[model samples]
Target chain A: MSQRPTAAGDPVIVVDRLTKHYRVADKDPGVLGTLRHFVRRKHRVIEAVKSVSFDIAPGEIVGFLGPNGAGKTTTLKMLTGLVHPTAGSVRVAGHDPFRRAARFLEDITLVMGQKQQLIWDLPTLDSLRINAAVYRIPPAEVRPRIDRLAEMLSIGDVLAQPVRKLSLGQRMKAELLAALLHRPSIVFLDEPTLGLDVNAQTAVRAFLREYNAEVGATILLTSHYMADITALCERVLLVHDGALVYDGALADLVERFAPYREVEVELEHPVEREVLAAVAEIDTFEGRVVRWLVPRDALTQVVARALETLPVHDLRVSDPPIEQIIGRLFDGRFEGSAAPPTHPPAA
Target chain B: MRRLARLIGLFWSTAVAGEMEYRVNFALAVLSSAGGLLGALFGLSLFFGDTDRFAGWSWLQALVVLGVFTLLDGLTSTLLVPNLGRIVRHVRMGTLDFVLLKPVDAQLWLSTRDFSPWGLPDVLLGLGLVIWAGVRLSVSPTQALLALVPTVASCVILYSLWFVLATMSIWFVKIHNVTEVLKALVAAGRYPMSAYPAAYRVFFTLVVPVAFLTTVPAETFIGRGQPAWIVGSVLLALLLFAASRAFFRFALRFYTSASS
Candidate 1:
């Protein structure tokens, strides 16, 4: 699954049993509960990230995927030194992230889609200048850095416009420019393309790819969009319930989890459900079309049998959407129904 | 140190540019500041209507305290309120994550990121009143120079107090009103410490330390400052400033960024 040769010197990011626990106050949803809470508060400790461990090589773009509360963002926060892990260890760029030494911070950047650091009332350039000063990029280098990034991001025109006036896509691009102005060696992005139109999402993905290629910066990003992962990352780390469920190539993930393919049949006439069930597991049935979920090994046999016996006008076989496969995986449907094979068959 | 100063200059310049968008607000700010100053002067006059001295200090001496209070209040609006007051919002919105991720010191960034020129009117008027009172008192040049030490110390103490309160928002994310309460108490600085009752003076001196914010500075300005009080004022400012920085670091450990 990992076709790229591992970096020579060492992994840029090392995480061994990294974890975080948060103590959250508990209260019910009534005035009486509020009174009770006020009298004696009760705190429950939640293990947000539970002993998750994975290493990322330099210049590798790894997608962090999970359902809400899966600790992907929490893990990113710890790696970026925004939050301290409760247990285990994480070393990024030869520094303990929790220490957040200046040298360590200079080498890393984090961008969260929903949270913006730009000043709302000011022009995007104003915020960029502040970033420049904070990062101590020499004054002479600031303009060229901004110009280069703005060119890559295609946000040059909007840099002087107030952030509030720019579209969400423009603002996100400007944010990327500011985040990358210092040329960090590692970038942590949480849903960078979130809430953007399709074209904007594509633009941001392209910018990230170009930036990574140009600077050779390691990137770890989490997004709900499967296209983002497929387009940007060859490798992915999937987390569920505060634990690492899978970490491997994107292709391997599809092969291992989605062992079945979808076969769509355009029938000449309607067929009985019982008769169709003999050929394959029926996914959907209508007047003249039938869809079946057939195992990878049995797909050809099932299609042959369906064509021979059934009044088949046409048939096509393709893998299910990755989003659907992952959604079902998290739903625990695949676990009970089509138990994943321990090892992927030889390709 | 030079780098920090440069950064602050950049921060304030950008802040001014950002604020310039609302040019009319500056006019309103000046109007309100003038109204506030006049109201304060009127209130002070009530105490001195019948006598030149109250609480063993002349009216001019008390006006010095009022001037210091106005100066500190202006500084608050200019720096502390605009910057530290947003800590709660940042904590709630999770933008504090960006601050922490920056290579610069988070405390420095948060404490000096904003500047409001609306307070400049109060600052200038306050300085004018202080100098006017000094002229009437025949204050020597050395006394004026010496007075600056405690004035600067008062600014530090005031900043530290505001920062400590703001930093608590990490644990209690809705503590905005708590800072307002501190402001209400610090308003006591408008009068000399001797004007207050014994209990009020004790609370102001020991608990909130409002006495050191204006009264001690005013005493120094009038050339009646005791050496012990001046030393105490500087020491208190340094201690509180250090404590505020330590407190900010401690609070950050508990910062659970708002769940995305």
Candidate 2:
């Protein structure tokens, strides 16, 4: 529930203590188990999302990060009114999302990477036309709006082609075009760049940035790729085991979780381990090169002393990669005892 | 309302354009329709072997019942099967989430999302049979137009039944064959209600409602329908349509979309 103060404006999305529980049927494997299940069924409740609260301001791009089954998609579903929340309140675009009022629906769009809304056998333009009619977009504006989005996504050529005939990247871009055709003010994207090549991922990222810039729409995105987050989002919300673990600036997260900087040094000659240890904690060394893990507070002093005392040929200082830090966080390396519940492995 | 109409227009045009990609399927559909009609006529002939009347109705009057059944079957193929048949797939694949996210009514969207022109030949042939039979019977235009009321009512009733069964996929998730069972039961509508014995007549009329679908409409076509029955047909259609809408909304409450 921890959140930094949002920018000054009426927040477009206000989620308060949102939670969801699913009553899943529990069954064992084998013929006997099937007979027993058929005769006497068993059910268990799974708490998918727990008391998650956050506010998103207009025109803000927030990254929602989580591991598999961390309930990221569940939260997005609640916000989009696709699934009802088991408990708690969600207000998006000044209306209760589950009510799904026409006005509220007109103001929001959701794009899931693994699912598509476009007709597979039809040309992409056909699906877009249906969207225009569903959203009641003016006849005069539909063509221009489509052209503008197609140009931005660089998917103008594929509009007339059947969706199944397009490449994965082209299909994803077309999905985005269909989703955004109504000019929704709030866009919820779940793994929008998933399974795309690096080049396609970068293109999608760039298109999102430019689209957000042009429309000033609020965006909440979830992606397994850190590059997607780093490129488009300045703020991030990290969820683990169905709970919000961190919410703030992405840089602040790295700063807090990873407290040391990596300094690589190339020595003029092989240096004794004791000499390098005197300046900073030695991480690794090979012949003339040494890597040091220096605390943030001691970075300046350690670098200055290294130049004064050691046979330092060239030195470079930088923070560890964000992926490594986030990976460690999820591994519970920092908390030591944050063990998640485990169920019986599926048969 | 206008937006809904426009959306339907767009949905069907796109659907037709997509189905056109397989022009050969349309030819296959026409051939199958012709073959099916011939088989139906042959089956009807079996009941009329030493007598020109079946269940107290002349051969021409019985042809009207078969025509109504053919028309409904065509409608089923053109709209119900192609659209409702996908509800199970959508529920399984999690694409229904996108359907609910749209600004339009989810039931309407699901119901009219796709159209197949493959069933058009059956519809035309069915209408032609009804007209030819009417000509042989020397029926008046006013009486023929009166038959349309029950025909439209039959269409609504059939749609509601198919839709209600399809909506059950939200819970069952794997009942694609359930509709096939319903289709088999509805096949009884191809014959007049009088063709069955007392027990079967009651069963078809009350339980499965095959009587109202074809027999009642045929009765009205030949100018022998009871006023109470026509009123009952309209009322049943309206009632079932409302129930289908309510049932769909109720089903959605339990629609735990498949995990992404």
Candidate 3:
């Protein structure tokens, strides 16, 4: 649906065959090799992004999923204009990202969790005010806006503290708030909850959810935490080896690969294991419970046979955990399902 | 322009406020900068005690060059030195991504994020030394005013030179202490350019431009600076500043495509 110019509305972010190539120096390993490299160095062109194409509608919360070096951060950088594409094009908020015009910048915010813009030696409030001033916000509007955002992140006290003194979580919250102080129309978060404890991750996720609901701003978040994608993003874009592997609803991605239901059966008493085993492959066998993996098409038939033949008190059929589903996607088991490399390897 | 000023004001006030919290550290910084200047000058005076002229300059003229050195040192400490190191660290740490995302010019933001008000004492002390040397040398009012042209040009040249060093970091992120080399070379400004041998004089003046940074203004204070000195300093400042600005943009382009 997103690939086509939909009648639904215009896409806020459009990428048409966007690509990025980097020439990297290569060196042989060893003291002798180093000496050789010093005389004659080798270079290789890295295809950081390979003709990836996608569109994001306004107010869409889309997760960019990938392993390290899979071009997730690279794509975020491209969209925000921090990194330029080697070929093709990217249009964000109706402007070329590379221009980095004030109007375009005013409508966008990029928060890279690993990189902070806050003045380290000063209180975070100062950094936030600096952000406001950069956007030319009025003095009257800056304080209240910062306070509101800081409070939303539960960082009222933390904002007054020097950034270096705060913990990672608090500092991330402050950075997030400062990046959003301008209330941009688009928000790009690259690993925003990275290196955070579970509580802090949950807090940041809740804040993002509330923020999206309140402002309806389009958010593209990249995170290693599947829980974040599952909680906020109804759709996701999966990138592997600098290519778009899958771009669809988060549920659809699982369904396309998994296409099975996990049936956990709780029995009233012990039964011959063979009776349940015949219905479906057994996942776990305990005293009172037996779990089965059954294809979606055969779910009904398997459940009926289990109930008729075995001593079953209760049964539940549910989707597998998203983490397991995603793990399988990356395991090369689904290589044919959504093949990553569209072209053959270059010699 | 007003917006830029407001942004600078915000950074300056915040840094001052933060520095004020560490009173002992602030006092020590002031003491250290002033102490460093005093020690250097003490050494200079001891050397001058034996010689009537150092490369044809009297003791007081030598003091004028030292004062310019002190003034430039304070400006670097308060403005360029801390901010350049911050930018270098950001590039290495990848925190520069946040700077590039801002609506302001990335170079502008990187160059002006800090202000060490505690370093102001060195600038004031340097000015005091220049006045004392002026009185001792019997420099007329017209000559003193004439020196202002070269003094301002020297500051411009020094800033542009340091910026070129900072710009190199967008490509070579591995070098963390480029400024250490800069600080070492800046020590050359502590003496009259003429005191060095002719070969050394030509290299520092043309290549590093340390002569314009210190000696030209000192020469003007003694009414011995040629009119060509002012002309040459202004021309050098314009050329270097433009080149640095162009280099900054080119480096940014390279960083955008190559560094990711």
Candidate 4:
């Protein structure tokens, strides 16, 4: 039912078989080898990104999902033009990023998780002013935009305070404000909600949703947090072992991995282990609760048998969490159920 | 030009604000810089006592070279050196992603983003000695003419030379030790190039360009200037500056930030 194309014109970001490789020296640990390395060092080629390709349409917030070291960051880096690709091509806003033409930089921004762009010793406002000057944004325009972002992010006071003194969440908010000051049409958000408290995460997520909706800024975000993906993106790109395994709606990912619903039962008294075994595949059993993964067809039969034959006080049926589906996909524990295609299906 | 001036101003204020946050460190930095300068001057005074003229040049001329060399050292140590170290760290830690995304030339941004207010004192003291040495040299119009051309060319050559060395770091990630090599070569600039004899002087001028610092400048001010040498040095500086820019662009092709 989904109508997503591999490459589309309305797409803001397009990558075709993009790859990046680095050559690094190698040396043995022996004294002789160490001395020999001084004279002639060995080298190896590391393929960080292996022919990864994807297309992101305008105004779309696509969650780029992958475990650490799975080429997620590499792909993001290539898209943003922070790193050059060894092979293939990437175009954002119809500009080659690695060329780093002023026109290309003006249309995009990248927010790294652990790193910061703010001057460590200066106030956030001062840093923003430098960026403003660099972007050549008129002072009249910069002032009002900064004021509006500060108001929305509730960081007016922190802008005057040195960045070193700001709390982690406050710093992130300021960082986001700094990145967006140019009103870039495309944003590469690398773990933007990382290391943030729940309140702050909610605030950031809210701000992102509002900003994207308001400005139609296309965002390609990479985060391990399922909440971030589920909340912000209609589509999710799953990368595993440096390859794109799945790229579609988030629910498609869930349905592809876990088609069965989990049935959890709370018993008045302890039930025999054999009874649960007969009911379904007993995944885990605690004091008052017994959890089982039964096929969607068997869920009804199992629940009926448990109610008829065993002591069942309460029961709840729910789809597995997106995190669990992702875990299973990466863990190689489950094969593709390959759910029927659906258009903009609920994720 | 306006943007650069504003950026430099803001850079100074922010550097001061940041340093003030660590008050003890700032105080120590000032003290150490002053102490270092005094120690170098004292060492030179002791050496100069044994000789009336070093390689046929008076003590005043040598002092001028030493002062200019110290000023260049201050510039390198307090700004260029520190920023280069930071650039390597930023590359490793992926903070450079933040820099690349900014709407500015990343190379220009990285090179000049850092400053040290303490270095201003060295410039003041160095220029003072140049004037003092000029008075001692009889202040001839010909001497002044010779001095001005070579000194400007020397500064440009030295600055551009360091720029090329620092830009190498973008491609040769393992050359973080390049700073030590640069520092060692800069140390040679402390002595007048003429004192080293003809062969050594030629080597310094062509190979290391240390002659650009003292010998060329001192030659002009000391009334022994050569017209061809001044023109060649200026040509060399322009060529080196252009080469550094080209090298920077070439290295940009290999830069893949950790974020990417």
TM-score of chain A of each: 0.90, 0.92, 0.92, 0.91
Query: Clashes in model 3: which pairs?
Result: none
User: What would the TM-scores of all predictions be?
Assistant: 0.92, 0.94, 0.90, 0.87
- Candidate 2 regions exceeding 4 Å error are A1-5, A336-347
The DockQ leader among the candidates is 2
Clashes per prediction?
0, 0, 0, 4
* Model 1 regions lying over 4 Å from their true place: A1-5, A265-278, A285-290, A303-315, A333-347, B21-24
| Candidate 1 lDDT by residue in tens digits, A99-125 | 889999999999989999888988988
CAPRI-style grade of the A/B interface in model 1: medium
Candidate with best TM-score: 2
Off by over 4 Å in 4: A1-9, A27-42, A265-291, A297-315, A333-347, B20-60, B138-147, B171-180, B256-260
Ordered list by lDDT, greatest first: 2, 1, 3, 4
lDDT score, candidate 3, position A191: 90
List each candidate's DockQ score.
0.71, 0.76, 0.57, 0.53
Model 4 chain B is weakest, by summed lDDT over 10 consecutive residues, at B251-260
Write down the RMSD of all candidates, one decimal each.
3.2, 4.0, 3.5, 4.1
DockQ winner between 1 and 4, please give it: 1
Local distance difference test values of all predictions, in order: 0.88, 0.88, 0.84, 0.79
Model 3 gets an lDDT of 0.84
Ten residues in sequence with the least summed lDDT for candidate 3 chain B: B251-260
Q: Write the per-residue lDDT of candidate 2 for residues A262-305, one digit (tens) a residue.
A: 99999998877898898888898888889898888889999999
